[model samples]
Target chain A: MADNETLDAKIEALTAEELARGLDIFRQKLGAAGALWLQTCVHCGLCAESCHYFLTDHEPQSIPAHKLEQVASAFRGRYTLVGRLAPALTGARPFDRDLVRAWVDAAFGRCSTCGRCSLNCTTGVNVPAVMRAARATLTEMGLIPADLQQVVTTALETGNNMAITREDWLDTVQWIEEETQGAVNDPAARIPVDKHGANILFTVNPREPKFFPLGMQASATVFYAAGEDWTVASEGWDLTNYGLFSGNNAEGGAIARNLLDSMDRLGCRTLVIGECGHGFASARWEAAEWLRERPGFRIISFLELMEDYFRQGRLKVDPSRLTDRVTLHDPCNTVRQGGISEPQRSILRRCVTDFVEMTPNRAENFCCGGGGGQLAMAQYRDRRLQAGGVKAEQIRATGARVVVAPCHNCIDQLMELNREYKLGVVIKTVAEIVADALVLPTITPPAGEDHDVTS
Target chain B: MGDAGLRLGVAICAVLAAVALLLQVVRTRSFGTRPPMAEAQGSALRGILYAFGPGMAPSAKESTRTHPVVYALGVGYHLGIFTAFGVLVWSMRDAAAGSALPPAPVRQVALVLTALGMIGGISLLVRRARGPLLRAISIPDDYLANLLTTAFIALAGLRLLAGSLERALLVGAMLLLLYIPLGKIRHCLFFFPARWNLGRHYGRRGTFPLRH
Candidate 1:
C-alpha cells in the first residue's frame, strides 16, 4: 500500500494501458451471475427508494441502478452486441480514468453494498455483488480509497485490522478474564486461551481489545454462565476481515486462513465467530469461497451458540434485568447476507424485558451506513453521515434507549450517528446486553479436588 | 407488402430473434456458474423455488409493495406479451391453412389480453418518460423497446377484434421480434436466471425463505 501521494500520482498518471488492464480485470470478475445481473436490469428505478443513500441524498446518482451504471455501461460497451454496434443507444461508455474515479466514488463512497437494494430490485439483480465487482477492479488498479486501503493493508500485514499487538491482546484478554471471574463470583472461572481440544475456538473483532475490553468480559461471563468449553486463540483471534470490504480475495483468503490455521492448532472442533457482522458472514459463508476449501470444523456465530445454550438448558437469562427499551439493529452482513436473523431476535426476546422492533427489520432492515468499509473512509465522512440519517431516523422512531448492534462496524457507525444526529441512544453489543441479563447458577466446590467451577 | 410476404418476413424475424437469444444465452452460460465452495447452511433449491414463486409476490418485495401500480402494470404487460405470442402463432396457423379466425371465444380472449397488455405498456412508457427517477436511469433503448412492444400489442388486438390489418399486425410483430435481442427487452432472456441466482445466493446462506 503506497502513501496517498503515490496513489494520487498513480491515478493522475493512468493511461489507456492502465484502462485496458482495469477493463480486463472487470471482464474476468464479471462471471455469469454478474453478467445476468447487469443484463437483467430494466431501469425500473424501483431500487432507488430502497437505498439509504438515495433516500437521504435524493440524488439520482445515489440510486443503486445509476451508481452501478458505471460498471454496467462499460461492460455493455465492450461485450454486448447492441453496445458494440451502437453504444449510446444502450448507454454504454468506454472504461476510462473518469469511469475509474466514478467506480471508486460509487462503489466505495456512495454505496454500502448493504443488499437492501438487491432484495428490493424488481429484476432480482444482486446489486452489492456488482458493486463488489467494481471494487475489485478498482482494487486491482490500485484505486481504492486511501483510508479503506490502509485498513486492508494493515489487516494483511498485521493479524488484525486495528494492528493491536499480541502482547496487548493477551493483556486485554487476561484483564477481561479477571473481570469475568469477579462478575461470576468464582475464581475458578477462566477465559481459556489456546486450550487444546476445546469444543469451541472463539474469535473477536480487534476493537474489542483495543477500545472495548468490556465486550470481551461480557462474552467471557456468558461463556462461564453456560459452562461452555471455549478458548480464544492469542494469535488469529481477530474475526473482522477488511478483505471482504476491500474486495481483495487473496488478502481475504489469507486472513480467513489464519483463523482456520489457529483453529487447527488449537484442535477446536467448532469455530465461534464473535459479534462482527462482516466477519461472521466472511467466515461462515465466504471463507470457503475465498480459500476454495471447506474447513473440517463447523463455523457458527456466537449468537447461535448462545441460542443453543439457552435451548439446551445450559444457559439462563432473566429479562427483567434489562428494563430499558431495547432495539436490535440487524447488521446487513449478519442478518441479510449471513442468515443469522432469528437467533439474535430470539436472544433479544429472552434477554430484554422491553424489546421493540424496527419497522423493517430482520432481512429487510436498512443499513446503519457503516458497512462496505465506509467507517474507514474519512474522505467520505459527510456523505456517510448523511446516508446514515435514514438509520438515525429508524432508531429515533423506535425511541429505544439502547441500540444493540451485534457487528462492531455497525456499532462504530451507529455511535458516530448517535453524536451527529444527537439521538441520545446508547449503543451496545449482544454480549453486553445478554451478560446484563444472565442468571448464574450456584455451584458448590467438592472437597479434595480442585474445583472446576464451569463444570 | 402482401399477406404472404408479411407472413414470410415475420417468420424470418422470429427465427432470427430466437437464434440471437439462443446465442446470448450460450454466451452467458459460457461464463459458467461458479459452484459455491462453502458448505450449504440451507438448500439452494428451496431458495430458488421461493425466488421464482412467493419471492416474486408484491408482498415479498419492498419495491413491489411500495409501487404497486408499477409492479401490476409490469406484470400485466408481460402477461399480455405472452398471451399475444400465443395468439400470433394461432392466427398464423389459421392463415396458412386458409381458414377463418379461431372460434369467437378464443378471439375475444386474445382481444382482452392484448388490450390489457397495450394499456399496461403505454402506461409504463408514460411513467418512464414522466417520473424523474425513472427518466434519469432510462436510456433511449428503454423508450424504443416499450414503444415497439406496445405497438405490437395494439396491432395484435386490432387484428383479433376487427379481423383486419393482418399485414400491419405482422409488420409490428416482425419489428418487435427483431428488437427483442438488441435492446433492454433482452431482460426477458435473463430474468429467470437472475432471480434464480439471487435465490440460490440467499438460500445457500439460509437468508431466503426468510425465517422472520
Candidate 2:
C-alpha cells in the first residue's frame, strides 16, 4: 500500500482529463438526497463532537461539516448561480486537484461514514451521504487508498475480498463443521453446502474462512442447536462487499447479483447474512437498490435470525454458562445505519448473565474506527487507531472483561485497539458468546419412532 | 423613500424570493430521488413524524444537549423570523384596508417574541464569529446571511416597539428577501425536506422512531 506521500504524488499527477471524469462521476452520483444534504448543512458545528475522528484530534478539518465542505464546495461551484458568479462568497471551488486531494483525505482517511454526525446535525444533513458522493468521485479518479482498492479489486476478480478459492473455502467450512459436531456432541450436526430447498442460505465474510474460522464454527454450532435447515453456498458465500466501501455501484451490484443467483440456485427461503455489519447492510438494505431488482427471498441479519430462534423457542441457552462481564460494541452500519439494533441486544440478554451497557449504546454508540473499509486501508491504520480512542474509552468505562462486537470488521479493529490501548479485554462475536451458552435439547425417541434417524 | 415606495419594494422582493425559492424546490426535485427498491421495515410516515416532532427535541440529540443555549437561540431566532413575517403580513393587510393597528395585546406579544428573536440572532451571530468550530465551517455567505437576518429581526422588533421604523424595517426585509435564494438562507426551504429525507432513509431501515 502506498503511503500518504506516494498517494499525494499520484493525486498531484492526475491529468485534466482524469479530473473531468471524476467531476462527471461526482455529478452523476449527487442525486436528490445528496443534493438535499449538501444544501441543508448550516455549519452549526454541533456535529463536531459527534464524530470520533474530530473528537480524537479536535482538528477543524476533521469536523464533519468541514470534511463535507470538500464536496459541497464543488457542488456549489458547478450548480449554483452565486457560486458561478462569485465563488468566494459561497466558498465554492472548482473541481481541481487540490479539492480532490482534500476530498480524498477527508472522505476516505478521516471519515468512517458512520452516520453519527447525521443524527446530531442541527439541519438534519446526511453528512455520510455527501461524503460517499465525494468517495464515488475519488473512486472514479482512481484515488482510492491503495490497500482498500486492492480489496475491492480482489472481490471483483475472485468473488471474495480475501480471494479465497473454492478449495480453501470448502476446507475451512468442513473444518468448522467438524468443530461444530464435536462441540455439540452430535454426529448429525452438519454445515450443509449448496443444499437445495434449504430454509436459510447463510453467507459469511471472507474473513471468516481466511482468518476467523471460529466465527463460522460458532454460527454453525448455533444453527445446529436450533435444528435449522441452513446451507452455505459453494460460491457467492462471501457476504462482505467492498463495493459498499469503494462507492462503485456497478461492482456492488455485481456482487449482490452473485448472491441473488446463489439464493435462487439453492432455493432458500431466506438469505441470512452472517455477522458482518457492512455485509448485512449491503445485503439487507442496499442490494436491491444496487441490482434494481427485489429479491424473492427474505433478507435478514444472522442476529435477527438468532433472535427469531429465541422467540420461537427453537434454541435454548443457559446464560449461567458465561459469567464474564460483557459489553456490546454496536457496529455503526448494523445499528445506526442498518437498524438491526435490538436483535443483537435481545440475543445477548438471553445468552449472557452479566451484561453491561456502554454509556452511549445502540444508535448513539461510537464507531470502532474500522468501518468504511478502514481495516483494509493500511495507510490509515495510525489515524484509525487514534480515532478509536473514543471507543477504547467507552469500553474501558464499561469495565467489562469481554466485548462482543457482531461485525468482523469491528472485531478486528477492537482487537487491535485492545492491544494498542492496553485495555486487556477479550473481543468475541455474538455467535461465539451464544455458542458458549447454547444448551442442546435432549432428544428422547418417541417410542422408537425415530430410532433409525440420523441423530 | 416614501412609505408607498418602501412598501412596494418589500412586496416585490417578497414575491421574487418566493418564486426563486419555488424554482429551487423544483430544481431540487428535478434531481429526482431514486424510489427505494427494498422492502420497507417500518413506516416512513412514522419516521417523518419523529423527525419533525420528538426528534427535534433537545433530549433527542446530543447536539442540543451539549449546546442548549445555542439550540435555544436557534429555535428562538427561527420563531422570531416567523413572527416577524406574520407581523409584516398583518401590517400590510391593515395598511391596505385603512384599519387600526393590531390589538394592543397582539402587538405586545409580537414585540416580546421579536425581541427574544433579535437577541437570539445577535447571540448566534456572535457565536458564529467567536467559536472556532463554527468559524472554520462558515463561509462569507454564512456571515452575510446571519447579518441580514439578524438586521431584519432587529428592525422588525423596532417597528413593533416604536412604530416609526417602518421604512428601515421594509428595506431590511427587502434585502433579506432578495438574498434568500442567493445564499445559505435557502436552507429555510431545504431544512424540512432534508429532515424528511433523513427520516425516510432511516425509517425504511427501521432505525428511526428508534426502538429501544
Candidate 3:
C-alpha cells in the first residue's frame, strides 16, 4: 500500500467530477431494500434514543433520522419524482461538497452502524443500510477518513490490515505454539500453520498479532485442548475487513476473496473466524454477498465451535477458576446482527463460575462504540470515547469484575471505558477466559480418535 | 368543485395513484433482484412472521415502550386512516348508485372513529411542528402528508356526524388520494414490507425472536 502521505495526497487531489462519480456509485450501492427504507422514514425522530451518538451527544445531527436526511436528501434530489419536480417540497438538497462532507462526518464519523436505530425505527427505515450507502458514496470519491482509507489501502496492498509480514505471522504462531506446549505440558500441543487439508482454517484479527498476542495464544491453547485440527494460513490471516467498514465493496471483495483463495489452496473444509466479532460477521455473513462469490467451505465463528466442544465433550472447562462475577458484552456484529448470541453465553456458562447478564443485551446491547471502523478512525477518538459512556454505564450496572466480549474491537473500547469510567474491571475475550479455565486431560487422545470424555 | 367535478378528480387521482404505486413496485423490485443465497441458520419465514407479529407490539420496541403516547397515537391514526379508506370506498359505491348515506348508527360510529383518527393525526402534526429535532428532520412532504390525511379524517367525521358537507368531504378525500402516491404518506404501502424485510433480515440471522 502507498504510505499515508500518498493516500492523503490522492484523496486531496479528487475533483468535482470524481465526487460526482460518487453519486453514481451510491446509486449502484443503493439496493431496493435501501430505497424502500429511504422512502419509508416518517421523520418520527423516535429513533434518537436508540443511538449512542444521540444519547451521548444530544446533537440533532446525531439523531439517526437527521443523519440519514443528509444522504436521503441527496438521494431524493437525484432520484425521486417529487424531488425532481419540486425539491423544496420533498426537502431534497442538491449534492455539493459541503453536503458530502457532512454525510461523511455523520455516516462515518458519528454512527457505528450498530443497526440499533433500525431496530427501534417506528417505520423500520433501516438507517444503517442507508448510512452504509452514504459511506460507499464517500468512499467512491476517495473522501473516506484518512485512517480508515489507510487501513483499507494497507489491507488491499498487503494481505493484512496491519500489514504484518509473512515471517512475523509465522514467528508469532511459532512463539504461541511454544507457549501452548509449555502451558499444556505436552510437546504435541501445536499451533499449526499452512497445514493443508486441515478441517478448520482459523483467521484472527490483525490486532491479535499486532497488539494482543496473548489472546491468540489463548485461542491456540483451547484448540490444542480440544484436539482440533486447525491451522492458520501464513497469508490472508487477517480476518478484520476495513473494506466492510469503509463501504468499498471492491476492496471488501478482494479482501474476502484472498481468504477464500487461501482456504481453498489449503484444502480446508471449514473456516473458523477467531474471536473477532465484526470479522466473523463480515466473512461469514457478508463477504460472499458483497463479492457475489460462494465459498466451498462452511464458515463459523470460533465461539460456535467452542460451544460445540462443550456440548460434545471435546473440551472441558472448570468454571471454579472464574471466581469473579462475569458479564458478557454482546458485540453488535456478532450477537445481534450475526446470530451468534447464544453460543457465547453458552460458552461463558461453562467457562465461568458466575455469569451475569447485562440488561437489554443480545441484539439490544449498546455498541462498544468501536464498530464501523470507529476504532481505527483517529478523527473520531473523543466522540468514540463519549459514545462509549452508555456501554460503560451498562458495565457499571452489571457490577461484574470481568467483562467478556468476544469481539476484539469491543475489548479495545471496553478497556478504554474501564479506564475512563474507573469501572475497575478486567476485560477479556471468551476464548481467553475459556483457555484460562480449560482442564486438559491426563492422557493425550490418539490422533483422529473420537472420544466423548463426559458422555 | 361540485359533486361531478369532485368525482372526476377522484377518478384521475385513483389512476395517478395506481401508476405511481406500480412504478414504485417496479423500481423496488429491480433493487430486490438478488435473493439471499447464504446458508440459513434459522427460518426467515419465522422471523418475518415475528417481525409483523409480536415484534410490532408497543412492548417489543424500546422506542414504542418509552414513548407509549406517541406510538399509540401513530397506531390509532393509521387504524383511522384504514377505517376512513373503507368508508371512502363504500361512500364512492353509494354515490355511483345514487343512494344516501349508511344507517345513522353506523354513521355515528364512523363519525366517532374518524374524529379519533383526526385527533391522533393532528396530535402527531403538532408534535412535529413543536419539536425542534422533528422540525429539523421533516420535509414539506411530512407536513403535507399529515395535513392531507388529517383533513380527510376531519371532513369525513363532520359529514358523517352532521349529515352535511358532503361535497367538502369528497374533495378532501380526493386530494388526499391524489397526494398519497406523490408524498411520504405512501408509507402506507411501504411500512409492512419494510417491517417484513427487517424480520427476514434479522430473523434469518437468528437476531429476531430476540434472545436474552
Candidate 4:
C-alpha cells in the first residue's frame, strides 16, 4: 500500500493544463456522444459482476460499475453541483497515478468489453462507453500501458492484431491449405483471394493465420466441401480489431471501416467472420453501430454460416466423424452480443451424435476469459481462467469430453482451462467438426497427373 | 381541463399502452430474448422488493457502492417523480385548480420530486462523464437517460412555473405510460421483476442468491 502512494503522488502531480488539453481533445472528438454518457448514469450497479476482473478477483473496485464511478464522479465534481454534493457526501476521492494504472489494467486488460453488462443494466448506462472515454483520456496523456502500446504499434504496421506480416499471413494460409489437403484430401480446394462479387467474405483472426492455423485449415476445408463462393481480402481485411481491446473506438472504427467498405466495393452479400468472440463482437456490434449509418452488410459467424449451409442443404452432415460426447460453450460475444446461438446448436446436432446442452447455452452464456480482448491484454492471464471457473463447472456438469466452442477466443481460453482443471475435456472449434463431417463433391481436375490436392 | 379532459387523457394513454403491449407481446413470442431465457421480470421484481426491504444501501441488485448521497438522492428523485405524478393525476378532474393530473399543491410536490431526481441523476452523470474509467466506457444511452430524465424534470418545473397545467399534465401522463414501454423507463417496472426472477433461478440452482 505504501508503494501505491508514491505512484499516486506522481499521477496527482500532473499539471492541470495537461489534463485539460487531453480532455479538450476528448471533448472535440466525442461531441454529443460524450455529453450523453455524462447525462445518463443512475448509479445502479447491476454491471459489477459482468466484468471478469471483478468476477475473478471479487474486488469491487475492479467491477465495471465501480470503475465507471471513479471516472464519472470526477466528471461530476468538476461539472455539476449535485455531482459535487454526492461525491462530497459519498466519499468521492481524487484520482491518483495508482488508480489510473489499476484502472488501465482492469478496464483495458481484464474486461472483454462484451457489452453484456450494458444490456443487463437497468438504466442502460453502457460501462464500456464510459471506459472508452477514460481510455482516450488516458491514452492522450501518454499513460497507455506498454503491452497494449506494442499491440497498437504492431497492428498499425502489420494490419493484423498479432502484428503478423503480410508475407506471414499468406504463408500461414498456404500452410493451412496444405494441411487441409492432407486432412480432407483437397489440395486444389482453391481458397478464393480477393474474389470480387463473391457471396461471402471469410475472415480469420491473425492468430489463426499465425499460431493456430488449424482453425483456418478446418474452416477452409468446410467452406470448400460445402461448395462456398467465398473470398478473402488480400489487404486491409484483417478483422480482429485490437483498438477494441483498449476501448479505442476510433481505431476500432478505422480497422472495421475498411472491411465494411471493402465488402461494399467487392459487392459481397454477407460476411463470414472467423472464430473470434470480441473480434466478432467488435466488428459486428460496436464498429458497425459507429458507421454513422448502417453499412448494409450482414455478418454471420462461421458457426451460423454452417448452420445456414445445413438448413439450406448446401452441405450434408455426417455425425460419425465426431467420436466423443460434446457440449456447446457459447462465447459471450457470440451468444450475448451476436445472437448466433441457434446455428451453433444446429451445427452440433448435424456434426455430433452425442450432444448435451450446457445450462446457460445462449444469451446468458458465460464469457470466455479470452474474450473482450482479455487474452490480448496479456497481463490478466490467471484472472481470465479463474474467472472462467463458473463456465468450466457448467461444462463439467454436462459430462462431455469434447467442448465445442464456436469462437476462437473461447477455444483459446478453454484450451487453457482444459490443462488447468484437467476436466478430461478437449476443446474443438465448430468449424473443425463441420469440416470433418461435411460431405464434399468430387473435385474435377484438368488433364492432371497423379499429383492432385483436390479430392 | 375538466373531468372530460382528464378522462380522455387516461383513455388515450390506456389505448397507447395497449398498443405497445400488443407489439411487445408479439415480439416476445416470436424472437423473445435471443436464445437463453433470463428471468428478467422475476429478477427485477426481486431486486426492487429487496431494495425496499433490506434495500442494500446501493441496492443489492447492483454491485457498485455509490455514494449514499447518490442513493438518497436517487430515492428522493423517484419519490419526487411519484409525488409530482400524483399531483398531475389530481389535476385531470379540476382544471382551474390546476389542469390534468393534480392540483397546484400536488404539482408543487411533483416539481420538488422531479427536481430532486434530476439533481441526483445529473450529479451521477457528471461524475461518471468526468471521472476515470467510467467516462471511458460510458455510451450515449447512459448520458441520454440522465439528459432526458433531467429534461423531463426541468420541463415539469418549467411547466408548473408557467405553462398551462393541463398541457403539462397531458404530456407527463402520456410520456410516463407511453415511453415506459419503449425506452429506459422500462427499468422502473423491470428492475424489481427482472432481479426477482434472476434471484429465484439462481437460488433454485444454488447459484448466488442476491442478498441486500
A-chain TM-score, model 3: 0.93
lDDT of 3 at A442: 73
Candidate-wise lDDT, in order: 0.88, 0.87, 0.84, 0.63
Ten contiguous residues with the weakest lDDT in model 3 chain B? B29-38
- Whole-structure CA lDDT of model 3: 0.84
What's the lDDT for residue A422 in model 2?
Answer: 98
Candidate 4 lDDT over A209-242, as tens digits, reads 7667777888888887777898887766677776
Clashing pairs in 2: none
- The C-alpha stretches of model 4 lying farther than 4 A from their native spots are A1-13, A25-52, A84-86, A90-102, A257-269, A288-298, A441-455, B1-212
lDDT of 1 at A350: 92
How high is the lDDT of residue A377 in model 4? 49
Tens digits of per-residue lDDT for model 1, B7-66: 889899999998998788678765556789988888899999989888888999888899
* Candidate 3 C-alpha lDDT tens digits along A315-334: 88899998999999999899
Model 1 stretches astray by more than 4 angstroms: A1-9, A442-455
TM-score of chain B of each: 0.93, 0.94, 0.91, 0.63
Can you give the TM-score per candidate against the true fold?
0.96, 0.96, 0.94, 0.66
Q: DockQ for each of the predicted structures, in order?
A: 0.76, 0.74, 0.71, 0.05
- DockQ, candidate 4, comes to 0.05
Each model's total of backbone clashes: 0, 0, 0, 72
Of candidate 1 chain A, the 10-residue stretch with the lowest lDDT total is: A446-455
| Residue A161 error, candidate 4, Å | 2.4
